[model samples]
Target: METILKIENLTKDFGRIRALNNVSFTIEKGNVYGILGPNGSGKSTTLGIILNVVNKTSGNFTWFDGKTSTHDALKKVGAIIERPNFYPYMTAQQNLELVCKIKGISKNIIDEKLEAVNLLEWKNYKFSSYSLGMKQRLAIASALLNDPEILILDEPTNGLDPQGIHEIRSIIKKIAKTGTTILLASHLLDEVEKVCSHAVIIRKGVMLYAGPVDEMSATNGIIEAKTEEISLEELAVALEKSPQISSANVDFDKVVAKLNTEVSATEINKFLISQGIVVSYFEKRLPSLEQQFLELTNNK
Candidate 1:
């Protein structure tokens, strides 16, 4: 995979406050990455430093594998670090034209960008007349005016109603489908879990975990089973006797067991059959991202 951005021991300080400390991660091409944490967890600070809007106190980051200057590299990147400003009276089309002029790009791509964000039909609508979701869609359209290779969004769905949030997420998924690398910083666990393929968890300027979202739930083993041929208590005792199972407990009408590494639901079933027992129900429980997120951040 082509590395788009590489950060080595990235650190930032705001006077006496250490906003970021030794944070390091790499973003590859054509992947959606989520920088996740609770509010005030240095997510925006990290994005700001990388975007060159704020200077890093210590450590280093290279864009495009250190192949180009920051100024040139940024030309291929589009970002929204804060609320985007636009003339309330200006039509969405006119506002994007202004962005084209400022960026010195041709206005020819204006329609294409608007359509990409599902705002082309509202091109002539005044910015002041549009709803908050429409305004956000226009902001996204403006970011794409340069036809950037990478898009950076800081809390893009923050403070939006459910419908508004759905619109933004749909637009993001659409953009990702076109193979644009996206770096999204958000505090919402559901947003990250649904939209991003990989995530990095940050807390109070500390990096807790970084990797694929699926791996977060894979560290723990949980299996839920139900039986009609045996009592729940009997099933639980039988499960605990298996070498692959660490512990088993009765929950309601079922037995829940925690398995050792490399253990599978099929293995548990085979063991039960060998013990002259048959299970009528079986399920492998995969922890949700919300569950893992709380466990990780709460521990710190």
Candidate 2:
């Protein structure tokens, strides 16, 4: 597949605080790639650097494999990096019309783009009168005014209710069906899990993992449980002594352990029970993306 964006040793430092740390990755065409991270994890900073809005402290990036002039290459991308400024008094059509004029595009595709976002019915509604969901859809429509090849959205569903989120997600998926590559930056793991085909996990401006979403969603050999007989600290020590376990920690009422193998849950239970620790309850559970994210971010 052709590469759409590539970053090499991307780094950014603000005084003594490093916002990005040698982060690197590639985005290929036709992938819904999620830049997954928590707040202040350099998600926005990476986007800003790539979009030429925020200056990077170091490193470099290329778009369209350097096939065209920088301006022309950038013209192939549309983005909603931050909150858009819409004229409250203007209707959705009017707002899009203005964007068209500023972008030197046609007024012809306004209705078509609004229709793609399911906003054609409300095309004449004033921006101030639209609901949050509708307003967000209009912003998406404005970004699509130029029909760019790739779309970049930063926290596209940031402050919406569940229904609003669902609506926006559906709209984005619908747009993706039209063959536009998408780069989504979000802290919502479930959203990324549902909407993206692949994801990059980042923490403290560092790339922790990057690959297929399914691969990232695979088991991390984590097991969470509580005991009735043994003290939490004792259970943790017992878990540490086991050859099948790699690391163990106590989180208040629960003791969590990372197993060395997938089938070692029974071994873990057996060892703890043999060590005079009661296994009150046990479950062989797979790690979730939320758990993976928490482990990656909290531990480091």
Candidate 3:
């Protein structure tokens, strides 16, 4: 994979407070990368530094493999750090025309950009008349005006309803299919899990983990089992005594057990049957992103 952006030991400070502490990561081309953390965990600060909106106290970042000047490199990058404020009374088309003027870009591709964000039909609608979702879609269209090679979004789905979030995520997926690199900064774990191919998790200005999202899960297996013949407490006690399970407990109406990696769910089932426990339901579960996220942050 081609490297689009590289940060080496990047550190940032605001007076006595440190915003980022020797963070490093790489953004490869054609991957939707997510920067995830809690609200005050330096996600935005990192993005701001990379976009030259904030100054780094130490270390540096290279763009386009250092083949172009910072000014020229930024031309190929489109970013929306926060909810963009457009002229409320202006039509969507008129607002985009203004954006073109401000960015010194030609207004010829306004319709194409609008269509990309699925807002072409609403082009003539006044900005004030549009819903939060429509306004967000228009902001995306504005960012696409330059036909950038990379798109940087900060909390792209911040305050929208579930439907609006779905709309924006779909548009982002559509854009990713076109081979554009996307760098998303968000505190929403599920948003990153759904849209990002790779993720960098940060907490309290420290980098916790950075890699493929799938690799974040623990190696130990988890299983949920329910037995109708035996009490849930009985099942939990039996599983806890089994060598195949590290721990077992009654969770709600079911027995949730953490299995040893050396053993499989099949072994656990066979053992339960030997113990005269007939399970009504059984499932091997993969840990979710939220579960893994809580584990990572909570451990530190």
Candidate 4:
């Protein structure tokens, strides 16, 4: 895969506090890359630095393989760090027209971008009359005014209802289908798991995990099993005896075990039965992005 962006020991310091610390990662050309972390984990600061909205204290980053200058590289990327400022009295079309003029791009594409966000029908409506979701969609349309090759969205679905979130997510998917690499900063693990192919998890200005989302999940899988015939202590002993099992915890009536890739759920089940334990419930679960994320951050 071709590299779209590369961060080399990127560091950012604000007075005595470091917002980002030696964060390094590479995003490929066609990936929906997610920068994920809890609030105050430097997700926004990282994005801000990369977009040149917030200056980094040290280190550096490059875009488009550094084939172009920073200013030129920025032209290929459309970003929304937060809610965009639009004249409340201005119509959506008028707002987009202003964006086009500012970017020195043709205003003729205003309709196309608005249509992409499904805002074409209300293009004549004043920005003040639009709902929160509507305003967000308009902001997105404005970002697309230049037909950018890369899109950077910071919590695009933040502060919206489930339906509104669905709408925005659909629009993002539509954009990605056009082969635009997307860099998304979000704290919503479910959203990132659903929308992103790759993930970079950070906490307290430090990088925790960076890899394919599936690979992250596979690093530590969960296996849930229960057998009424076996005592909890006996089950724990059995799992501990097995090299495949790393750890097992008795959570209520079931034994929740964390397994390595070398161990299959089938092996677990078969081994227990060999000990005359009949499982009443057995299930193998791949760790979700949320599960892996929490374990990596482990703040609690």
Task: Note the Cα lDDT for every prediction shown.
Answer: 0.86, 0.83, 0.87, 0.85
What TM-score does model 2 achieve against the real structure?
A: 0.77
Q: Candidate 4: minimum summed lDDT over ten consecutive residues — where? A: 216-225
Across residues 1-300, which tens digit of lDDT does each residue of candidate 3 receive?
888999988898899998899999999998889898999899999998888879899988999999987767787888887786789999999999997876678999999999888899999989999998889999999888988889999999988999999989998888888889999989888888787888899998999988887787565757888988878898899888888788887877787787777677788889888988889999887666776788788998
Error of 3 at 182 (Å): 1.8
Q: Against the true structure, what is each candidate's TM-score?
A: 0.82, 0.77, 0.88, 0.88
Q: Model 1, poorest ten-residue lDDT window?
A: 213-222
> How well is each residue in 1-300 modelled by candidate 2, as lDDT tens digits?
989999999999989999999999999988889999989999999999998878899898999887776566666688886565599999999998997777688899999999888899998889999887788888888888898888999998988889988888988888778878999999989887777888888888999988877676445477677887778788788888988778888876788787776665777788877987777766666666676777766766
* lDDT tens digits by residue: candidate 1, 1-300: 999999888888898999899999999998889999889989999999888889999999999989998877887888887576699999999998887877678999999999888889999989999988888888999888897878999999877899989999988888888889999999888887787888899999999888887886556567888989878999999989998888888866778787777777788789989999988889886656776787688877
lDDT (0-100) at residue 90 of candidate 2? Answer: 96
Clash count, one per candidate: 0, 0, 0, 0
- Highest lDDT: give the candidate number: 3
Better of 1 and 3 by TM-score: 3
Identify the candidate with maximal TM-score.
3
In candidate 1 the C-alpha lDDT for residue 92 amounts to 96
Model 4, which residues run further than 4 Å from truth?
Answer: 217-220, 226-241, 250-255, 275-281
Q: What's model 3's overall lDDT?
A: 0.87
Model 1 Cα displacement at 206 (Å)? Answer: 0.9
Ranking by lDDT: 3, 1, 4, 2
